[model samples]
Target chain A: MYCVHTTALSHRFSASQQVLKEIELAVPTGSIYGFLGPNGAGKTTTLRLLLGLIKKQQGEILLFDQPLHLHRLQLLRQTGSMIEVPSLYGHLTAKENLLIWQKLYQCPKPHIAEALQIVGLADTGNKRVRQFSLGMKQRLSIATAILHQPALLILDEPTNGLDPYGIIEMRDLLKTLNTQHGITIVISSHLLAEIEKLVTHTGIISAGRIVFQGTLNELVSRQQSESQMILQTANNTEAAQIVKTFVSDVVINAQHISMPLLSKEKIAALHRALVQHKIDVYEMNAIKKELETIFMELINQTKHD
Target chain B: MTNSFTNCLSAEWIKKRRSFSSWLVVVGACFIPLILTIMFLVYPKQILDLHHSGQFWRILQLRSWETMSIILLPMGIVLAVSLITQIEFKNNMWKQLHTAPVPFSSIYFSKLVLILLMLAQLFVLFNIATYVSVWIPALLNRDVPFPLYAINGTDVLKENGAYFIASLPLISLQFAISLQFKNFLVPIGAGLVLVVGGIIAHSWKYVYMLPPAYTALHFGEASGSTKHTDHNLTLWALGYFVVFVIIGYLLYVNRKEKG
Candidate 1:
């Protein structure tokens, strides 16, 4: 079952300006779904809509097989979210801030300490939130969200403003939350590279619309199909002529012929043809496309279309 | 749901206790009584004129209520409401709080109830401080007649109770505005303008319809033969309180936080 599903979701700030347009999301249960988009591309807006923080202008949102608007309180009871910058009471201590949500959620008192420990903030005793570092505040925010052991966790840009180590720690914590606790996490990030290693599935959004949504392996396979193979030969012109028959869109330079890496068999055929043609191949390299590149290509395609 | 409301109230109390603004509002409430105490101590002859045949308790109550109604109570409500709502706004915690399992009504209701409770506490404290201000001087100076027994305790409680009831409309109005505006100064500036404008418009027949002017009108009755008993004004205040609360809740439910 999908942890969250939205169909025909749209939002507008004004008559002429549309913020989100017909956005659809399918986040599977027990999987870490990364909501990726450029800045101001409505990732946070989509998250807000899913969390019922903002009223939907036009959409059907389902959370845990229940309509979100009809059962917001009941649905939200099993969900936890931290949107944008971690919203914390500055005057209260980190533990005090968590206690507020703990009481609100009716979580046990020991859960606070457990959450603090999970976030690596267990040692921050009696420290006011205002005095904490940005990363520390982010962890505390995550702790508050996870304190009740919700089934679904929605975090928008959870690693935003974190140091490298902080990002790694957050990634690990999210993984543990998903793996050990069986929580479905929907995290959003502007950078695909930031959450690529952590998310099992992804929904790439551009211009308020989802351009791609599927498992990470599907995205990787798609990227692989668009990958390039570089062949450096003693005679580039002859190698290009022999390679063009096997691979379309082959480009020739002074000593190299480049073409799309269609398949391993095609590369082997090109190698045999190059050898038969007496073209001395010095090096052959396959450069797989990065997820970030695929993300940019998807967004750019939306812009042009 | 009952548990949620209780939890919300407890959370609000914790936030209020840790907040400096809460202490600021408490200090704001004590200002008029403190000034009155000083006035009585320094200018006893000028303030306590037994020769004029006025009851000391009556004069003390009048002076305290007059000062509080004129500027202190309205300003205190404005500041207190702003401070209470600022706890959420300053931290940008509304979105987080809204997305929590608890009902938005519980959050808003608990906050409004807490603000009212704070205002009530201040009213009681002001009355005690004002009484002490009079009793202390009378105790120190044997010449001044202390009308401790002569003063009707029930009348004092009734008058102060009336003042608190009359101020509810203003509190509700300010609380609504404070919740709508995230900036602390905007609500405060609007509140100041309302108070000044209400006082100036008090001569108009419909001026009593204004929330800030309700305090002045209710206390204005105290100087006359009515003696702090304005059932119509209290009813109107209650009506205004309900209307403002509904409006505030509606605005809160519909408001979109800036991303």
Candidate 2:
């Protein structure tokens, strides 16, 4: 069953500016769904709508088979969220802040301790939140989100403003929440590399629309079809002529010739042609596009269209 | 549902604990009495003259009530409500609180109830301090007869009770404004301007329509020349409280958190 599903979701702040347009999302249960978008791409807007933080102007949203608009509080009871910055009372201690949520959720008192331990903040004793470093506050927010033992966790840029170690810790914490706790997570991030390692499902949004949404492996496999073979030769002009006969759409620069990888045998045939032409081939390798590259290509393609 | 309400209140109480702004209300409540004590100490002859006329408590009540109703109470309401609502705005806690499992009604009303309780505490503190202000001078000046009979406890309670009721409309109005604006100074500045305008325009009959002016109108009723109680002003205060509270709750529940 899908944890979250939105159909033809669109939002506009004003008559002149449309933030989200015909956005659709399907997050499978027990999968870490990465809501990927650049800044100002309506990823935050969509997340807000999902959590009922913003009013949905148009569309249908279903969370756990129940309509979100109809069952917002019921659905929210099973979902925990941290939007943008960690919403913490600076004057209160980390433990005090957790206690507030603990009371609101009516969870057992010990769950607060458990959550703090999970976020590695169990030792943050009596330290006011304002005194905490940004990473500490982020962890405290995650602890608050999970203290209720939610089935779905919605985190917006959870690793933002974290150091390298903090990012690694956040990634591991999210993975543990999904795999160990059996919690579904929908995390949004602008940095593809930050999310690529953790996310199993991805929905790439551009200009307030979902440009791509599927499993990470599905995305990689789809982009793999466009993988290119790079050939570095001693003689570039002769190499281009020799490789053009065997491969269509051969692209050559000053140092190398590049073309789509059509088949495994095509490389062998091209090598034989280059040897016969005395155009010495120095290197030949297939370069599969990375997720970051694919994300940029998708955004750029949307812009051009 | 009752459990949820209690839990919500407990959460709000936790947020308010150790909060500098909440303590500011206590400080503000005591400020007028401190000023009154200093006035009695510095201007003994002036106080003695009122005592000679056998109207010391009446004059003290008038002075204290005027200062509180015209100046301190309205400004205190502005500051207290601003601080209470600013907790959420300053920390950007509105979205987090709204998205939580707690109902929006609980969130909104819990804050409203907390502000009311804080204001009530301030009223009680201010009254106690006023009595202490009088007691200090009486103890120090052995020769000057203590006007114990003049400072009737029931009268003080009645006056303060009236002041509290009169201030409710302003509290509700300011609470809404504070929640609407994120900047600390915006709601405060607007409140101060309205208060000054309310005081200056209190002579006009239509000025009673202004919620902040209800304090000034209550002060008018307390002065001996006017009747001790004005039923019309009381009804207006109640009307404004109900209307503003409903409006405020609706606005808060409908408020969108873009971040």
Candidate 3:
């Protein structure tokens, strides 16, 4: 079951400025869907729309198979979200802060302790939130959202402002939340490198549109399909003449031949042919770092088009 | 009440604890009474004639509400209501709240309910403090004679009820403004301006139309200093209260950018 589904969702802030074009999002159940986009890429706006925090100008949003606008309260009851900063009361202690949401959601008293323990703030009693570090505040925010034990969690830039240690802690907590608790998580960030490790599904947004959305493996495979390998030879000019017949789109460089990424069998056959033609193979290096390149390429394509 | 509303109220009360407005209510209600108690304690002879004239409670009501109705009550509501409503804005929790399972109406009305409850709380405390202020002096001084008259419950209830009703329009106005603006001072500044306008125009013929002037007008009539040109001014206050509340709720719920 899809935890969240949006179809043809679009929004505009003003007459001249359209924030989101026609966009669709499908976040599968029990998966951590990473919504990736640079700053002002409408990631927050889309999350806000999904949470029903922003009035939909033009769109259809569904949470847990229920229409968002028609069943917002019901959907929201099963969803937890943290947008921008955690928005905690500075004067209230972590436990006290939890009590506020505890009353709102009508959760049992023990759930407060359970949530505080989950966030690793179990011992922060009588200590106001103002004194807590940024990472601690974010965790408390997650606890507040999960106090009701919602099925879906939507967090916008959950790791936006954290140190390396804090980022790792947040990632681990989210992983546990998704794995052990069976919660569907949609976490958005500008850096793919930040959430790439944690998200089971990825949705790359650019210019208020979904440029890429699929499983992480699919993204990797997409990158692989577009990847190429470089072959360095003792006599590259002669290898190019021999290589042009086997591999399509082979471009000869100063001392190497760049060709489409071939299968292992194809590469082995090509290597045997190069050897038979008396071209000494000096080195063969498959191009790495293709994922980031594809991400940039997708975003830049939208920018130019 | 539904569990959702009850939960909202409970949550609001928890958030209100230890907040500055909590202190404001206690101190705002007790400040004049405490000073009055000290004055009566220090100068027992100050009220010797009023006690003999059997106007002690009446004078106490007048004295208690004179500053209160003219400035303190209106301004306190302005500040206290804004403080309560601004909790979400100051903490940047509106987005967090808007995403919760409970309806937006629950959140909006719960905060309004809290503001009203606090105002009622202030009224009750101020009345109790007023009685305590007088009793302390009567007990401390033998000459004051306990005023020879039982406390006139009707007159006391009448005054408190009128002031409380008169305060409704102003309180709702403040709530509506506070929800729109994130800054604490805008509602307060507008409240201060309107209150000053009301006090200056307390004697004007059309003061009945001005909700901020209702408190002052009630004071003027209750003290017999001026006849209420319109007895339905309290009704007018109630009318304005309903209108402002409806407007505030609509503005809050209909916002394209809620959080």
lDDT of 3 by residue, A1-305 (tens): 88999999999989999989989999999999999988898999999999887888887898989898898778887988899888899889999998888887777889999999998999988999989999999999999989999999999998878999999999999999999999999999988888888999999999999999999999998988888889999998888887787776989878678987888888898899988988889888788656778888888888888
Q: Scoring each candidate complex against the real one, what DockQ results? A: 0.59, 0.64, 0.82
DockQ class, candidate 2: medium
Model 3 RMSD vs true structure: 1.8
Model 1, runs deviating above 4 Å: A235-255, A262-278, B43-56, B135-151, B225-231, B256-259
Count residue pairs with overlapping backbones in model 2. 0
lDDT of 2 by residue, B28-100 (tens): 8889899988888777776677678676777877877777888888988888889888998899998898887
Docking class of 3: high
Query: Which tens-of-lDDT digit does each residue in A31-145 have in candidate 2?
Result: 9999998999999999999999888889999999899889887898899999999999999999999999999888899999899999999998888999999998999999999
Candidates, ranked, DockQ:
3, 2, 1
User: Which should have the higher lDDT, number 1 or number 3?
Assistant: 3
Q: What is the C-alpha lDDT of each candidate?
A: 0.85, 0.87, 0.88
Top lDDT prediction, candidate number: 3
What does candidate 1's lDDT look like per residue over B1-259, in tens digits? 7888989999888888767657865676677777866776777784557425567678767877886787778877888888899888889898898888888889989998898788778877777777777776677776666754476989988987888888898888998898888789999999999889888887777776787887888778887633333347888889999999999899887777522
TM-score of each: 0.91, 0.89, 0.96
